[model samples]
Target chain A: MVRVDGKGSGALVEIRSLDKKYRRGGEEIDVLRGLNLDVDAGEFIAFMGPSGSGKTTLLNLIGGLDTPTSGAVRIGGDEISRLSGRKLAAWRSRHIGFIFQMYNLIPVLTAFQNVQLPLLLTNLSKAERRKHVEAALDLVGLSDRMRHYPRQLSGGQEQRVAIARAIVADPTILLCDEPTGDLDRAAGDEILDIISRLSKEYKKTIFLVTHDPIAAKRAGTLLHLDKGTLLECTADGLFACKPEDAGK
Target chain B: MAIPLEYNVRSVFIRWPSTLVAVLGIAGTVAVFVVMLAMAQGFQAMLIGGGSRDNAIVLRGGADSEMMSAITLDQVRVIADAPGVARSASGDPLVSAEVVVVGAFPLLATGSDANVQIRGLSPIVLEVRPNARIVEGRFFQPGLTELVVGRNVSGTYAGFKLGSTVEFGGGRWTVVGVFDAGGSSYDSEVWCDAVVLNQVFKRPENIFQSATARLASPESFQAFKDAATSDPRLTVDVFRETAFYAEQSRMVSTIIRVLGFIVAIVMGVGAVFAALNTMYSAVASRSAEIATLKALGFSPASVVASFVAESTVIALAGGAVGVLASLPFNGFTTGTMNWSSFSYLAFAFRVTPEIVASGLVFSLLMGIVGGLPPALRAARLPIIVALREL
Candidate 1:
């Protein structure tokens, strides 16, 4: 019932009192509790937290991969949390791009084919789809390695392919869950540089979940989560109590 | 929207060992199914192929087969004289009064004794049965202890070649010729003169087992049937030769088909379980991949379709292998006891195109049935749970 007007209003993601709960046997464990946040267009935000602090859960809720227990997630003026299962999947395909810690490239598909997967859901012609896939792989600097399978690519190259797949559809928001978690320091830095360039040059809104402090430092805004709550950390310390509290 | 079919195909090849288990299991089932149906088909073809639409058989009333029918010489004459009977070049009716009896003979391949039909034929038998022709040597001379063996009989039994002597019924009968009946049931028989067989088997002087006559035309069958059944003095059953042989094949073919189907179904049960186990493991091992696809916004329907497509591909592969494995059995000769004639009948295995198609369709159905539960399980898995698996 409460909708946030995000499209043409310069806001890309808007969350309000979002809560996620999981029941293990009999006890209800709160994963995300009463979370409120607003991300503007073309901004990059990093989510940092200890284990079990609901960082990935909040990203999943925003991407429509998982629904919030009792809150609304609005992106580009669409209330995704209220959408049904099939509609939510379609919405996610059109609006969100996902990058996982493990690269998550389909092992059987070559880099080009994996990047072309999300586009298969569209009604694009084969040639048109190929054109888009090649452009995305070119952007990721893997144009020459398009035919190489995931097992044949290096860790950093595989991650680059994953990033190409994540952005091939040109989704409005890019959700990266520990994108640099599995890479070495040099490979991880290369990935961060690409993410930073995507946000600044391509005008893409990005939300990244990570444990690496260096990866978090590249984001324009950094937020820390503890015990299902969100806190903003500035250069001095974690000073902002909450986005709602700071607004009050 | 559906996923590209190539994705499922490549996945099947990527997991070759597990796919091989499902394929070979289904292959075993389809092979058993096809080979058994082929046996039944061969048996049916042997009997049905022996008959012609323009010929009619005469047997005693209430008799189920020629072996059970007894025709007196007077009755044979009356039937042969019927208005619709066709005549040969000599103007005599194209009729044969034949005696049928079973004789035990040793198989050349196994040396085990089996019952073979000994037929006593009148002179006009080749005229009545146009398909029966001597392929080697000559027909037996009348009034002598001479016999001609069918090609299948000579091939299957010991000591039945031309110039060889077979001891039976207290005498040695010399084989004078070999006959072929174009793959008909008569190819399993040994032929001799009616008078000689009567004397050898100690049958009555004026009695024979059955009589067959060629009709003037196939349309004359109704007139022939009416003439024979209306005679109060003669108690006889008349049938078109085709209908008679088809009746003879009913019980044996049914038994064979039922046996074949039972074996296939038993093996099919094992195949279904093997497929189930293979698919469940595939789902388990690929949970993370499935989760990734789900995260990429693929619907559960697409996931289910992909897995089902993979399963069907495996089953069709097995079906193809099964068809190839059963190919060697086609036209391979073997023998079984004909319950109607109370004798061993040799036939070849027939693997018709229809049988092959049915076997493949059967395997495809098995794949669909076997893949359903696992596909549903894959679809119903919570995305969060699957993502956490890895």
Candidate 2:
């Protein structure tokens, strides 16, 4: 197994000395402290950690949703941390897709419209958008349920629709934060299967944050984040309770 | 990229109770604005319509209205002989020296004493005011105590109907005729023989209040005004009748407009707060949705525009309903005191296209003012914090 300590060759995402801090009434809390990692394209990396371990914070920085307090984050050679507001948004639309645990689909829009959201940023014709949306929905095996709204769809189905939305724009990277945290075990596995397929078949660079080890087992590489520090870990080491047996 | 309009529309209905309160609030504000301004428009229209561009009115130089002006028969003669005074085919000047006075009359509906204008003019009154016609009976005969009531006066005041005897100016006069003044402010007056009215009212027979003269041409007004004012023997001012009436309407119309705006603004503030509450509630309730949209790379401007558009649409709907509500009041006859004449003038509510358009624009302004703060708040919401709400 390869480590992700900023030494990967031809890495698609590079994080160097990244730090994030929050101020809480005269107290400065360090969420991420001098975190460094490198991830190559098409890698399905699952990040398992406790609450406040900065796993989601790292994903947010990589996705350009937040800026690190210190150091640089470069994705595909573009130093996204330096991008201005509108530029960062444009970069995000073009490159990053997000999937959340709650299946954050707009309640008002149908499944098809939800998937077509990112495509609206492009200058594609309406028919072209329709074609892409249908293909993405079909990939999630929800082609027949395109017209159903979020409330009409079941929990697992809503997550699948969210997955369709994430992939419809064919983004370069998928930043999924606890995408299956609210789901049953079967639904969780189903979401992990789609995410694994997205990485393998579409060659999408995936960064998944999850606490479920069974979900993390589907990843090509598994890492543990403990107190804002990242370390390589195996599936066997994942289930161990002892502090020394946790990660290498 | 812009957010889809369908999203905002569905959200509005999905949360309909608050939307309804906002809509009704805006609707009430617009309705009040429309009705109040329509009243001003109607009063101004009636008074302004009473005068013709080709007629000139001679009044005392310092007087603001006929009620305040006093012109003797001798001065009227000089005014009639002034340059640019039109003449009939018989070579007589088309002038009518009139005495204007206010009489207290019992209102038919409320039985309260209200002021009614009484005009005493020469028999040539109909010729000078071509719009006035005997709609029900013949005009009053000269040198007689017969009275001819205007259509509005006969209908609004007690004992002013045709053939009814009414006491005024220390005499019992018979209502022998009813005239229509072509929907002008003159509809609120009564006319009788100048000599008879002066005799009963105890004024000097030679004294009159104003003289209305038809001009040879509308362009002859300046010459007539110069001629009347320059005459040393006559202490009088002359104005194109249309201009005089337009000026007379200014005080009442301005008061109505100012009062209307003050009331509308007062109500508009409440409407704005209602809109703010609705939008803030919307933003708070949709925090997760907003975060999802932001994460999808919808710009802050797009989010702001979407929320503002929703508010504007709601306000526009309210405006449409308000306009519809005001339409029924159009041409519905009502009366209010004319400050210049100091008498009740009957006129209809005039909801012109311009007034309706102004109301809609006013509501649109309210929507923008009310929605902007909440929209900006929604736009500036941090994506991570809102996502955590999910």
TM-score for chain B of all predictions: 0.94, 0.95
TM-score of chain A of each: 0.91, 0.92
Task: Output the worst ten-in-a-row residue range by lDDT, candidate 2 chain B.
Answer: B313-322
For model 2, how does the per-residue alpha-carbon lDDT over B1-390 read when each residue is reduced to its tens digit? Answer: 589989998999999999999989998999999999999999999998899999999889899899888998889889889899988888989999999889999999899989999999989888888998998988999988999988899889888989999998899999999999888999899999988999999999998989999989999999998988998999888888999999999999999999999999999999999999999999999999998998998988999999999888878877888788888888988998988888998898899999999999999998898889999999999999999997
lDDT of 1 at A112: 93
TM-scores of the models, in the order given: 0.90, 0.92
In model 1, what lDDT does residue B303 have?
86
| Candidate 1 docking band | medium
Instruction: Give the clashing pairs for model 2.
Output: none
lDDT (CA) for every model shown?
Answer: 0.88, 0.89
lDDT tens per residue, model 1, B44-87: 99999899998999999999899789999999999989989999
Model 1, residue B169: distance off in Å is 3.9
TM-score for candidate 2, residues paired by index: 0.92
Q: What ranges in model 2 sit over 4 Å off?
A: A1-3, A8-10, A233-248, B81-86, B89-91, B230-235
